[model samples]
Target: MENKQLLEIAEQAKENAYVPYSNFHVGAALITKSGKVYTGCNIECASYGGTNCAERTAIFKAVSEGDKDIEAIAIASDNSSKNEITAPCGICRQVIAEFALDIKIILGYSKGDIKEFKIKDLLPHSFTGNDLI
Candidate 1:
């Protein structure tokens, strides 16, 4: 899928974010190598630690469906700013690295500004399943 299309899906997913505390809505879209797309929104919790990021939500959903070979992922936040780009957190980065070390990560804004980065670029020398082997 095109980056813009993937970003659009992520933006749509952002609307479903359950953020009653921080009010920061984030969305993510993961695209498998086979062209399957999984979209997720940030889900917050009262306990804070129970919160799930948008990226991980999408990745976990894909994994639950037995799709691990992710080709690309797009993330967008509904912060009402088009110039502000948000990257995945440390935990989300690690989770993404587990399945796709070289996956493309697309960070997008509401005004059409987008940036792409490889997973390795976000997490260099990451510890993956290879470390356990």
Candidate 2:
């Protein structure tokens, strides 16, 4: 699917965010190499440490479903700033690296506005399974 379409899915998924604390809504959509799509939204808990980011949620869902070869991921958020593009957290980046080292990362800033990046650009010198050797 096109980046815009993936971003649109993420945008829609943002509505399901359960952010009772920060009230920040985030969403993510990832497309596996098998052409399967997975969507997820940030889910916050009463305990701060229990919160799950939208990117990680989506990645985990795909991985659980046996879709480990992710080709790309799109992330969107209700940041209310045209200049600020939503970015995945460090943990999410590492998780993505674990699955695909160079997947495309699409950041949806607003309707029809997006920035494309590679995993290496977002997280340089990232630690992956190869590092364990």
Q: What are the Cα lDDT values of the candidates?
A: 0.91, 0.87
Residue pairs in steric clash, candidate 1?
none
lDDT of 1 at 88: 95
Q: How well does candidate 1 match the true structure in TM-score terms?
A: 0.95
Total clashing residue pairs per candidate?
0, 0
**Where is model 1 more than 4 Å wrong at Cα?**
none
Question: How would you encode candidate 1's per-residue C-alpha lDDT over 1-133 as one tens digit per residue?
Answer: 8888898899999999999999999999989999999999999999999999999999999999999999999998965255567899999999999987889999867466788999999999999998999
- Best model number under lDDT: 1
Clashing pairs in 2: none
Candidate 2 local Cα displacement, residue 114, angstroms: 1.1
Q: Kindly report which residue stretches of model 2 are placed more than 4 angstroms away from their true locations once superposed.
A: 80-83
lDDT per residue for candidate 2 within 9-122, as digits (tens), equals: 888888999999999999998999899999999999999899999999998899888889999998998862454687889988888888767899999654656889988888
